[model samples]
Target chain A: MAETTWRPASARGAGGATATTRAWRVWSSAAIVTAVVLAVLVVPPVVNLDEQAVHLADKLLPPSWEHPFGTDDVGRDLLVRCVYGLRVSLLVGIVAAVVATVVGTAVGALAAACGGWVDRIVMRLVDVFASVPHLLLGIFIVAMFRPGVWPVVISVGLTHWLSTARIVRAEVLSLRSRPYVDAAISGGASRWRVTVRHLLPGVLPQAGLAAVLMVPHAIWHESALSFLGLGLPTHQASLGTLVQGARSSLLAGDWWPTLFPGLFIIVPTLAIAGLAGAWRERINPRRRSELML
Target chain B: MLELRSVTAGYDRRDPVVRDVHLTVAPGEAVGLLGPSGCGKSTLARVAALLHRPDRGQVVIDGEVARGWRHRAPRAQRTAFGVVFQQPRLSADPRLTLTQLIAEPLRATGRAAEVPGRVADLARTVGLGDDLLARRPHEVSDGQLQRACLARALVLDPRWLICDEMTAMLDASTTAALVAAVEGYRARTGAGLLAVGHDKVLLERWCDRTVHWDELSGDAAADRTT
Candidate 1:
């Protein structure tokens, strides 16, 4: 008898989401899978090609079957360099995002759970952090350390955690007000127990969503730092380094070098963002019905 | 015994909802708290349950004054009473199965080993089918979920029970089932109860005595007789 009452709206074909959202979800999932597969399987072998092996004879080669993304001014394979650059950018972005998410979730949960002067102090700290432009702060932090992956990751991770903290704090505050949480408290669960068992689990998905969404931003932050010559050393083939190296070639009218690396950065960023959007839609109870379609 | 002594409480301390309310329920007694909607009956109920701290006045349990509210409350004091809120859906962890939800307090208090047995026993008592034990709140009807909530409230064998408009959202059959379940638990445990709602006939039928909100607060008697 209960079964008859819970026929999901999607099952009844009466959900609110339109075909456009449905299409977007499909495309987003596909893009994410394709990007991950490329990063894992294809990029590794492509990156093995000698990025610094210059061939003056083959300099500024345009897109051809022999040199797909064309050769750079140093005559090194642009395709190989771009693939290597993408791998580095993804590695930094993912690591930095994870760091930011962990810090944010902890801060957010602590601030909310304590809920007094602690909440106020933490929120004020978050505001202080948010007031600074991420890029500007990131540049200063990165400039302090040696030009490498760790410095860029640290800068991006530190600079980007404010939003996730704010998001997580908001989520925790709302969850705390929930009757279930109140019920848990009334049930003799200690403050620590309620936090660990109920509050943490409740905020995890929102934190995860925040983490996924932050990946593209982290990537962009890393790329910007690298472009400003304050990130990864020029010897390393990050997407930003490749773009920076292509400035001269671009001026000489060999646009392929700059364009290809730029494309590499944009495509994966959009793909990750798309995946995050689809994930957000899936977790939302109202939109979850739409996913079945 | 459960007692609220001259309790004045609300979301805002300065502008209290229920002022200087005094009420009590001895063991084995069922007291209905009758009030119109927005009369602060629910807020008073929360105070009685120790889920909310009154702006003023004491909540005495079994002649002992209650000191803390929520998780800070002593385990013996906190676990002595079980509260069933109005919305079973909102009062339940949506992700947990019915069995898990019913067994929550047991696990919360480090009695994990007793969960399966207690949950099974309560399920049977609440008339929850074996098949329904594995379902989430969204999978069940409001009535079915309320049954689970009743089972949960009684699972710990609490000395006191507070049902704050628990049946307000349910159909007649479900409400009767829940009331009967509460009655069975009370009969077995001799637990005191504070049933808060505006349903006069239902309260009159289920509770030993019904008290008006204004009467409890010592206000000038209004036309609150149902």
Candidate 2:
């Protein structure tokens, strides 16, 4: 046993203050929240076909302000539809990613903590699921369930959960080895208590970053499936549906309908990707330390 | 009193770190376990603290086999013995503040309501003030964290404090101060202590009697008394 050394209050306080400041710099909690809020607010009101009005009569008109994004053969507002489509696409992406992260993290934590046969079984199942291409798996699931929001959400969520599960499992495995975990055990903490209080908190920052990164991935997959006419029901307007409808007219010199919606999708996608990059930089200690110097 | 009757235990099955060893610490006695680095001092400490089960013989406390009392012991009985590790980092959670770390044993036994006063008292005794109590483990110096760990070990006022190389990481002055603090506590409460260390000088100065594992193993047939 070693003798306990006392540190002066001021020195200890300074150390704690420095650590907290560093943590705040690394996280930028406010910036993340603001990005999320901006995404929520800005993407919904942008309409693509507002400039072209009389093109409603022209059926499929070329790009012109009268129906700024031109007109579909059905005389619909491509701009309005694109704006609404952005909302739907973002909604599906976020919902699917969140569901996947939650379910995946829970299953992964359980498998890692309980280990032995349970761990082996869970990992084998994860491997089986991971071996299949997620897009193909999602398409198969959507086909089986019939196309709808929930089905697409579930399909993408279930298919993409392998990555999240793997990340969480690795984190939990490492956390279990720390001496504080042993200390918690010696203090008569139940397995569940240790997992929830110690293990989960340690892994949460990483999981959160992973969850954010998965959003764009899920969105892209969903869009691709929808563009192929496999996602989002017939009446619903997603960016993929808009793109699917506009593909036939691209050759007729009517690029406004597709171009406008594509820009809308790309802009948000890039923004989200940027935010994810920033978040990773903040949460990762190695990166944060580099920035500090 | 805690006793080990020819206990054998180790991380692996084949190579027992603590060989067949018999030792005892009577009630209210401060005994130091002295040995070299590879002599299994910590393993023996773990056995006494019930953190590990010996592969052979019995860990007997108060004339009864301790295995039977494992989960059946009362809360106070469980807290009657506290073990501190060589690394203070290992003893305390890095995420916890000094106050939380020191108050952990109290909270563990459902005595959280008594934490505020007890924490303040322990901090004062260990020379950790209000400011240090608010900081997390990594934020504080190693010496300060070790002091917090010591305070945590004593919060429940355990009868047997098993410290395994507890002062090995500290500077000389800090170690000396801690030694004096332990001595003061022992004088005041008359609690039994099992301080394990490789430093013979520390053992001689801090403990009433020194017990070496080699000596215990060398003369197994002799009825040894310390």
Candidate 3:
């Protein structure tokens, strides 16, 4: 190595000041995400998923030590049913978010990288998709197709990808103008190399953050479809279906079914969204407010 | 040799930032480009580096006419010169470490195995210790980041090195140190240098000759009717 007048950058370490806050955020985010993932993975196995476990002998029972969340009109244990419902709702939300991220990242990355007619077409397509209400589209799609898990997943996933696509597009658009990108190109880095090395790292954070935010939206979408009678089948339990099923019971003052299951949907959505926001902050603290939903 | 022959370049605008520009830097020569802010000296540097495609005219490198806006030179051909942009923060990928940034050109050219050794070598050359290689752009001062940029540029040992106002943000001593690093690299490889800045005395001190960019942004005779 040639000797020159090199110097230490700054006396103050970069991560020194924010270390504690970052550690706290990371630990909490990890713990929350782990709990959610564990719940999503573990709840169904422990709980009785069979909503048809009709116990007319225990019909409309309120919360008690024996029946924790109580029983619904079907006489099935509300606790078990709510757990199963959340499991299904969370599953749909996760799969749908994954699907959306994959599709969105592909569209966004391709559009931004290509940046000609492809960009115009993809962006216009996003604009067109963004103009319509996602729920209405999901409902219409569910109405067209047989109401099933995949149909709901597809409907919600496809509709919700517009945001991720937009996020990836915006990220790529900015990253493309970055001088490092230009430097890479000038240094003869191939298109794939540039995309994989430079562009991919830049886009992943925005895309992943958007996808995480989309989970709750997806969960809500599934619930809406089920409420509208175009979501999960009767044999299965989703939080939306459980809440909708409780509508009649609610009128009759059998509030345990609706109230408890509603919390099931709301809590997970809030938890996941909060964790996602925290994780996003952990990744890119600069654009804490600028992250596109 | 790096040559811009009657080049006109801009960012998707009809009116070019630089118009009908001619610039050349021969091997072992150091030329400074002095101009006012936004006068398109950086644009010309970009053209000279083949990083920006000119709207019109040609960028001829080593007697090869690398023309057309979209068509780019292949890996081996384009690796003849390395360019450091004005803003070190913008020019270096923040996610990557100084090690990764310095090794980028080598990795691009299928010399991935040599990255670690070359990175250590360049870190010392730029007067930056290997300890700083792991830190990010925001973690380091602009001077240090600019030194990393210089190291990255020199890692490839290209026939030409172009610094586009690279020292504008650095302190005097740091700037001198960076210039010394570049000079040391130049002495070793005998590469040409093109530096753009607003500093006259500095340019005079560092460059064998200096040139000015034509004012093509507004109020030029090239502008026609409404």
Candidate 4:
């Protein structure tokens, strides 16, 4: 029973009142905007083009006024492809992460709150799914359905939900034993009211951390599936598809195709991971205070 | 008035925490249950609060067995009793404001509309100020939290107040203040109270009669003699 003592109500700091805190707040907001813009707006325009000559002629063009990231084998702008690939990769990651979080949280809350046979059945199903490797599961589901964006999204999203469900269930189980829960029952609160108003909020702060951590994992899984040609189709130009397309070129003399797209895969994943770490740090500021005291 | 008729309750079959216990609290009377640690005082208090169902026996409130009045009582029966837990910190939801916590019993007792005014009055009676109502449990001192718990218990205007080591965590002065507050409330409401504590002096001072549970067996005759 790892009990987290509730923070004092008066400790909730007022929003944007202090100068130093406001500065950091502004900086974080700008960082978020920059990350979104790089992934969404800037990248798509650069990557949306079609020409074999454009791909070849732009190939190996170094960062210059003319070709910022140089060119690939078919002269398509490496920078453009990288940007567009980033957009697609980020979109898949975010959408799949959201789907996994919502599905996992709802089902987990239901199972835990409604214990008995519902809990047993849901947890047993989760255990079965957990035993399978996420990559293999994702690939199998993508292959079963025709390879497409939403299909891959659903497949990967559904496959990763077990972990989230398990985490949330663990949280809910511990919360159920707390005295406030008993108090709520004794106070004659309906089961649903207790679950929704009391248990759910206690579980959410942890669920948020889980969601952040899951995004990178989801992105990587989607990329791997796409790299294996079981993800979004060729026309979609995801980072995974880009990596797959560039694999042969890498074996040949050309490295630009693989290198740029690989960066596309790695950079955003690292950024998301960084954001998750920062969020965890922010939420558990008590850990630092405990050390200080 | 509240009565426990040969109440037998425990977590399991092997060892009954409370073994065929019988007790009674007359109207407007304060009965202190005195026992050492691990003497099942808390278990008995829970049974009296209806938080725990007895293995065998009846919990009678106002001369009617609880099971018999189940249909007729509804929210009224629940509202007729309030429990102050051993640890006030664990008694109320940490997320709820003092106002919400105090008003909870009122809402639970199906008197939601009366909560706002009732809560304000209870807060004042319990010596909590207006500023404290907006504060969460952790924001307040332990004494304040316990007072809030007391305020919560008072909202339903329960005929019986079951205090299970309610002052155990408080310092001497704070405990004395709580006792005084209880005395004031009793004078105002004429409600029966079952005060459970290990502190013999405090129990004796607060209650009209003290019952050392070990001296009384499950026999009604034994209870009458005591």
Candidate 5:
């Protein structure tokens, strides 16, 4: 291995993989979809909505030709407020989801693969987290840390990964029993090779599904935290804070402020969760077929 | 040479499947192990093949204790032995084709550039034709999958081969063909073989010497005759 840096044999074109379809799913096929998801995700942060432009003269206007969603209290455009709120929500969702999934998958793989006290301890920790209310934990995390994107990300990301970890642990447990892993290890293939080649390819689909599902959870958590003033500061408007701020106007019958931002939150949460199912089917070869999307 | 000294291994702590077993396969020699269905010969082969960690006992290979299990053996040590299981389809990765499967050890040894040629050569040696190389595990029959698994096992040109019930699922005709392939491989490479099988005639025919699982164990009253 010293004289020549080892390349994985598949890279040598020995198998002619493209010539036929194999049992495992191909991740690269999702490049088009993931790219589109990324593009839409990138849009929220870059497209500034000038949410802070307050016009006292144009205060409390209803949805009209000038403002599609109308103006909010203190005369900020509801469209701008909802959009900037979406920006913060997406940032928190994406970042927190990634961190949670990566950590969860790694921990789950280790706990299940190692098996014994390590497995017991990890599962017990998961149980502990499960027993506690996620909202309470998220609140505690935000309050303990500085109020910013990181805190929201950490709170939402950290609390939400238990499901992913549990899911991966179960999958890895079954995968460990599969003869291919044993064959690979027994054939003197290094543990790393067995893990990277055999184990992870199997675990990734479920883990990925969890990560996608986590986005909505993170977004919701961030919004909720911001509602309680534990999420992003009042100066930086997120979906949660925007909705929270509109609570007063809601009772006054000026419902546009609450209604518009709330739609932004609900619509995205539903869309992401719905899309997660299709994403799951597309990535798993056994389930891959003409999805009626 | 491969040696097992009182090697005992089991999945459960209360009941050891293979206990206090002693066996050896000399260099360039073919040996056969036969027993009833549940006599623990497969576990013994697994231990000798450096796949299973023994509870107590040592596996000495070519005068050194084979450093496998926890600490990895050197590249030379790793390439010195090949182990094949009874269920070829189960052992082989369904995701990979025969070519990629056969080329795994070569890839591990940093000789990935030689994989295509090596895969073809191994295919010929194992009686797996060139066209079967592109097919997945499910695409082939049990016989063909066995041949692919055998080719993969021998790809590293291992000095020793451990085949545990390798032909149990094959038809009589396929078994004959597989035997010929094993024989051909041995003739060319002079590799040692430890083959376990249910067929007494095949074992007797292929191996230089045949030993029963009872003979290797410490049990005094194992009265079954072969």
Candidate 6:
């Protein structure tokens, strides 16, 4: 065997205190800054409704200092409307993601803990849900309810939980075989105690990753539903509705309205995915030492 | 007394690893189980520890037959013995510090208030330094982590102790220190001990009576009891 060397623990950096030089940090920070700006713009008093008022004389103006995203055919400031639209989309996405994560984690943890036939049955149910394409199922569900925020949120949340459920179930199954879990049981811990103390904490990172990644998907799902005129009222400023209303202008040689909203959706999705990747590396015990302190 | 009567157990029921094993350890006595690697000694040790249920026969603890295994065992039966395994790293939770690891049993058994003092006392007994108690398993050497595992095993002060190749992965000096700690605990509490190891000379020195795996076959072996 080749000669081996050992280093003192002190020589290695602290686990999470280390600086990360990954390229994704730049994009993640930019995304966070954009989200914060959009949040500020959504504050009730900060948002000026006059920008959304009809000024037909100034209609179809291209991008400029006065109206950065230009005026729509009805003369509403495209920037203000897009910001409001993004705010609605973000709110719906987050609420839906939370709902999905909670349901998925509970179902997965239950299936794994119960094991035997219960596990097989829950996994089969997951397979059934996963077999159907998310967009089609989401649209089908949304079409049943009145076009509104909660209906869209419920539809997106219900359709997206299958992936999270699968991830958490796999994670919990792996964690079940860990020796520490056996040690906990041998130490006189009840099933519930072991589940709460060991199994749940072990699965949190993977579950959090699932939730973060689900946000972008949920946003797009809501957008698709809205664009199909099956989500949020037509007057509500959502990225989907804005994009849907801008379709005529987009084909009429005016593209700012459609272009800006499209960028708003794509940029944040990429940023969040990037941030989740960084988070996965940070929390992973095996690869944690590889990070610089 | 801790006794395994006609026990037959293995991972697979149809092909049991260790069969019809009979062993007993009286209070204050250390019984070393000596066998070569893959000779089913560890499997026997697990059966003796009540961590694994026997395919037949019974595990009689303090004259009472244990009716359950693992977490299903009665609280008194479950808490009656403390066990230490071969690999400390695999046995301990990575997220916990040495203090939390050692205090796990105390916390689990609802003796929460006694954790700090008991863990500190056991750490000293096992020769684990205060500085080492704050570190996780990955942050410490094999010897340091094994010392913590020993401390964890002895923290509950049970009537019985089971060491299943506990020092096999450790160096000689660590092995000596851990054996001394177990002996010291036994002397104080008069606890019955079942030390499972392949090292014949070490077992002869540490235990009151050492038994070979093959000797545990028939009724004749039970007659050689001390």
Q: Per-candidate TM vs. native?
A: 0.90, 0.79, 0.84, 0.81, 0.80, 0.84
Q: How many clashes show up per model? A: 0, 20, 1, 19, 0, 2
Query: Given the true complex, what DockQ would model 4 score?
Result: 0.25
User: Per-residue CA lDDT of candidate 3, range A1-293, in tens?
Assistant: 99796435332123442445545655665676677677667876665366568888888988999989999886888877877787789889989999999999988888988888999998998999889888888888888888789999999988988877777888888898889988887666887788889998888877877888888888998998998889998657889999888899899878788899888877667766656766775677554422233
Q: Tens digit of lDDT per residue, candidate 5, span A177-284?
A: 776665666556776777777777888878888887788888888988999988988768789988888898889998888888898887666666646645664566
**Runs of candidate 1 exceeding 4 Å displacement:** A1-29, A32-36, A46-48, A281-293, B221-226
List where candidate 5 sits over 4 angstroms from the true fold. A1-49, A64-68, A113-132, A144-146, A277-293, B66-78, B129-131, B220-226
lDDT digits (tens) for residues B93-115 of candidate 2: 66778888877767766788999
Q: Using TM-score, give the best candidate's number.
A: 1
Clashing residue pairs in candidate 5 are none
- Model 2: per-residue Cα lDDT over A89-157, one tens digit each: 888998998989998898899999988899999999999999998888988989987787888889888
lDDT tens digits, residue span B17-97, model 1: 988888989889999989999999998988888889889999999999999988668988888888999999899998889
Identify the CAPRI category of the predicted complex in candidate 4: acceptable
Instruction: Provide per-model DockQ scores.
Output: 0.62, 0.20, 0.45, 0.25, 0.27, 0.48
Interface RMSD of 6: 1.5
Q: List model 6 lDDT by residue over B92-166, tens digit each.
A: 888889999999888988999998899989988988889989999999998899888778777777788889898
Q: Compared with the true structure, what per-residue lDDT tens digits does model 6 show for residues A207-273?
A: 8877877888888888889998889888888889888988999899899979988887877766765
Docking class of predicted structure 6:
acceptable
Number of the top candidate by DockQ? 1
Q: Candidate 3 lDDT, tens digit per residue, B100-197?
A: 88999888879999988888988998888767889998899999999999888888788888889989998999999989988998898898899999
**What is the DockQ (computed on Cα atoms) for candidate 3?**
0.45
User: Which segments of candidate 3 are over 4 A away from where they belong?
Assistant: A1-51, A140-147, A250-253, A274-293, B68-71, B214-226
Off by over 4 Å in 6: A1-52, A143-145, A281-293, B54-57, B217-226
**Which portions of model 2 miss their true places by more than 4 Å?**
A1-40, A43-55, A65-69, A77-79, A144-146, A251-267, A285-293, B5-22, B38-40, B52-58, B63-78, B187-190, B213-226
Classify candidate 3 by CAPRI docking class.
acceptable
| lDDT scores in order | 0.85, 0.76, 0.81, 0.77, 0.79, 0.82
| Ranking according to DockQ, highest score first | 1, 6, 3, 5, 4, 2
Interface RMSD for candidate number 4? 3.6
Task: Name the better of 3 and 5 by TM-score.
Answer: 3
Per-model chain A TM: 0.87, 0.79, 0.84, 0.79, 0.80, 0.84
